[model samples]
Target: MNTPNPDTPNRDPSDDDLDHTVRPHDPADASSAPQRRFDAEVIPLRPADDDAPVHKDEDARAADIDTSFEVQLDPEPGAGPEPVDDGIGYLLDDPDGDAYPVIPENLRTLGGVGEAIARHTRRFAHRIAFHAVRTPRYGVLALLWSVVGVWRLGNRQLAWWWVSEQDYLRSLAVASGDSREWYRLHREVKETRRVRGLILAGQAFGVLAALLVMVSVAPWWAWAAVAAVGVPWLAHLGRPEDHPIIVPAMTVPRFRLLNHDVVLRAYYAAGLGHPDKPNQQVTFETTMSRTKEGQGSQVKVVLPHGKGFDAAVNAKKELASGLDVAPSQVYLTHDPSSHRRHTLTVMDRDPLAIPAGKTPLLDCKPRNIWQPAPFGLDEHSRKVTLSLLWISILIGAQPRKGKTFAARLLALYAALDARVRISVVDGKNSPDWNKFAMVAYHFIRGTVPNRAGDPVRQLIDALAEIKRHIIDTNEFLSTLSPEECPEGKLTEELCRKYPKRLFIWMLVMEEFQNYFELPDQDDNKQVAELLSFILAVGPSSGVILLSSSQKPSGVGAGDVQRLFNRYRDNHAVRFALRCGNRNVSDAILGGDAYSEGFDASALPVGKPYLGVGYLYGATDHTPTVRTHLADHGDAEKILTAARQLRERAGTLTGYAAGQDTTTPDRDVLADVLAVFGSDPGLHWNELADRLAGQIGDRWADVTADAISAQCRDLGVPSVDVKRAGVTRKGCRKQAVQAAADTAAAS
Candidate 1:
């Protein structure tokens, strides 16, 4: 086929033309010079006046010359048209004539040059037509109103020259011959309006009136008036030079375009773009993409300013309305200017929610006293129900996971609920549980009593008591018909009459493995019964089981499975914090639920996962992760209140018997008896004088002891210790008893 002429009009060239056109001086250039040269076909593209320079001769020469002798056709479509440069560089392999540049003047020859300019300009203008009009409308109106007002106020006249006086306004004021001098005059005018005018006016007025006496006083008042007006004007003018216009008053067209460009750039980057740029308001869509799997894309709209906060909030509200999710799930934040740049992030999850009017009980960090238990439990009712009904719950956490805090919160919650009664079995006597001792019906620090003592018997007795209480309460509930009980709340009278029966009792065993796994085999058997009672009948009697294991598997899978079985069908509430074993998490609820319940990747030092129905298939709601024991102080306060209650109720007898260990000394008794042996009754003042050295100032202690151990035992009925207050009669009875004891011993 004949070679297509690259210079021929309407003749498209091949790739060979493009490759050869870029080479330097060659044989083809010389050979083509004599035959058909492509030089005449070369099109020299011109740059705009403000754009970069173009070297036409060099480019043309480069287009015609070829390095090899073998001929190659022009790669570009030389004859058909010219190409367009869109800022983005063009690819050489384009098949469409759209890539070819059309000659500018030639286009006018074919059509109208004016039309193209007008068309492009119209398109560009229309692209921002609404914005251009909308953005400046408010400012333009405000400026127009100001101008009209100034015109109406005769402000122009105030600066106009008076022909009658042959004086321009400048003639009365000051004059500057040149532009530089005019600016200098501006300084003087400012000072005149601000500071010197009134004084000069007053001096001139004084001269006109010939009133020397009034000059200073009038000037002072005039100056004050000028200052009052000028200061406000200056204040109005005081602002950053770049931001000279007031907010809501000034319009920033360029900045707005910049903002628009930025938004568009972000949208494009996020793969969101509008087909029509003109005639439509900018559309903002979420950046999140949806996929086939449950995992989907989400958009995080970063608001630019305070106004942006309102936008974000509104956007979230609109989304929530559309999505049917609560507004709380919508997170609005001040994002970095770029992903890398800002530290100031203000976020509002719920913009419309009013704070509930209750103080948290534990009132722990961030959480209030009444705030739901962190780690897992969220509702007091659920925690109380579990305590009231569950046999045992195993709380396993790594250290500092707020396990103790959760326990304390649970205890406080039980204390607050009248239907539930709590008793703690702590081996370490963590100070957190001490306060609960008063309100807790039974607080056993191991069955051993004090540390190092035998806790096995004490624990067994307490467990037995707890079992008795559980059985009794269930029996009582069995007796009452649904009609007899309006609400299930048990009152103190009900508990008093049926001490073991009226309420649901919670027995919290801390470090239970220590007690249950005791060295003594008999003690171990006792623990087995305790566990059996909790595992078997506790749930039926409103006895919920809550225990903690450092290792659940270590406790035996049978027990774990048993617990799983009990709670699997009906677990009311369950929570765990920083669990080490994934198996445990799976065992509790399942790996999926654990992962869903807790953002384990983001867990802080003490945060925990709470699954509502994890222990028992109770509810499908995602468990709210919370820290344990909202506030330790609330636990202490409850214990204190319980102590006060016990004290008021004369439970003092129990406490007194528990701590009453004072015994009289045998020697002191013998000495007191020596003084009173001669007389059954004696003068009290005389006896005090005689025995002051023996008993010190606390002689009443001696007297009281004598009355209690001596006089009462001797049957000295006539000499009543309360009425006669006879120290001598009581001492005589002690002397008789002591002498008798001495003779018996000898």
Candidate 2:
């Protein structure tokens, strides 16, 4: 057998080569010729190449053979070649490369145009109406001043000429030049003199023409028209280009013109823009109108990428500095319609510097109790109202910081509505709530001496009464059909339809923390539990609970603090005025509210800002509001007016109806005498029915057993008597008269 050279690429094969490539066949056993051929077929033997390159180096020849075989094994047909990895160049050419984002210009402006027109029209009408109604004396003085202005027109023109000539002469004196400058200055002076003469002549001719027209018109009203038109014309002529002749009475905020450059510069100053990177530009959508009162400019800004609304809000002080205004004058707010967009309002003046004046509650027309009541003005001088429909309120502040005042304002507003029934629980027992007692269905105070001589008992009793009221209200609401009370919430229609049953019920608990932090743990827990239930479910049934606290955190004993937190959470409307810390603000407004910029702790301390607080949950943004000032005299007047309104509407009920309690000072003995009034024998059942009829539906369940219990407590005697052919257990007129005499003597 011969062996073949494996490295040879072009060696011709002989029979020996073929025998070497094929497997050796064993013929000694000799199964058959067919078996021998089958063994030959089992081996695949390739023929040696006929024309292939030969190399002196065997290693090189073997490499060539391997390369030629690989070339012959081509890729699958129509399969494209693999992509080559070009180092770093592929990344440079990628279509999805990272770069600065481009902001598209906002071109939709027709809506803005309509809004501007509407705002200006409203402002104009308001100004006209205000001047017409409130300043008749000023208007007359202005008219007289206008007549004087016309008489001084010539003098004003002479004054203007003199000023102009002085300015020209000063410029000439400052000039440094040679002979050429002297000739130029002389020619300029000559031209200036000529112009001044022409202006004076024109003014004289205008006055003469006006006099001629006035003489020709010669009517009773023509003199008035001359004063009106001539005065303004002369005033315009005398006025400096930059200043108005007559100063406006109101302090108007002067806003700078808004442009792209100003907006970009503001962003840069606010640290929202990168100085090194010029591409990080604030994109302006469009410039909105100045505010209705001409206080500020509203600009829509699309912030740079990766920036959020909170960043813009936090940078409000810097933005104000950039705009050259006070921090309070600049308002930065997010535009909810777009994520990258925000609104920049730069005011010329601080709106809060000026007092918001008294609340507009008196000026407001009679409104539905479900609608929002005007509480005060916001930071923008826009009216801020609070909807009292289906919401409980939690107001917290440090002492003497307007917590009680704010609570009273809300209560007073509610009192104005004939359909609203008020209950005032004044733990402070100040005279602040004395007038409210005349209108409140339940007025509980420390001044009302109870058996224990403790105000906490009165507070607990008020809470219990409110809880009972809630149950009654819910039961009444449940009986109404869905069509009448949709969404199971109180509506104005419901109040009107069931005036006796569905009137608005408000419970104002002032210094509420005092009640919860009582020494008696049982009383504290009971009060907290009652408040939690009322806060949770009373709103939907036309029942509102407004509570004020000096300390809202850790207020009660044990789980009572947790109960207070629960109550605070349930209160949908919250106000915090001059809190000592952020924790108090958050406790009243909710956690993170202070961090989010609804911080009442930042309010100023003192009487001027007494009722000012941060109000949340009533509007899209938190607003600082100064509640109405209702002093003792104001309260009396309001109470008197409200009482009359309620009386006319026939909605007055409860304590306002002059009910007497079971105490010695205010026992029911006098009322019993008034009811019996020399009538010999009034049955217990008859007296109970009569008392129920007088006290309204809240006490409609008064029964003979209850009347007897009350009489026993008050030391009044009952006896069986015969009257009009009937005999039953009853009280004699003499017995009731004697009890009343005894109570009066005591």
Question: Which structure among the candidates has the greatest TM-score?
Answer: 2
Candidate 2 runs further than 4 Å off = 1-253, 256-263, 277-294, 336-340, 363-367, 446-453, 479-500, 592-596, 603-610, 626-628, 661-746
Tens digit of per-residue lDDT, candidate 1, span 17-62:
3422222234435344433234334433222243555444754544
Q: Which one wins on lDDT?
A: 2
C-alpha lDDT of residue 206 in model 2: 100
Clashes (backbone N, CA, C under 3 Å), per candidate, total 51, 0
Q: What is the lDDT of residue 553 in candidate 1?
A: 43
Error of 2 at 411 (Å): 1.3
lDDT of each: 0.44, 0.69
Model 1, global lDDT: 0.44
lDDT (tens digit, per residue) of candidate 2 on 1-746: 12344646776645423324222333433333332222221313333453433466767645554443211122223334433335654344543122322521121367656756788899888778766675665555555656666567756667766545455554665575455765666677667778888888887899799889878877868888766676666556544567554445456654567666776787899988775686676777765657544567777788878877778877777887787777666766666666678767777666665666665555423446777877877776666788888888888899887777778777878888877888888877788898987777777775346753555545555665666667777787778788877767667777778776666788888877777776556566767787887888788777888988887877765678888778867788898888898787888889857445566765666666777888888766888786766666776777877888788888777678776321223346655565665577788888877766775333344457556656765676768877788888877777777776777789
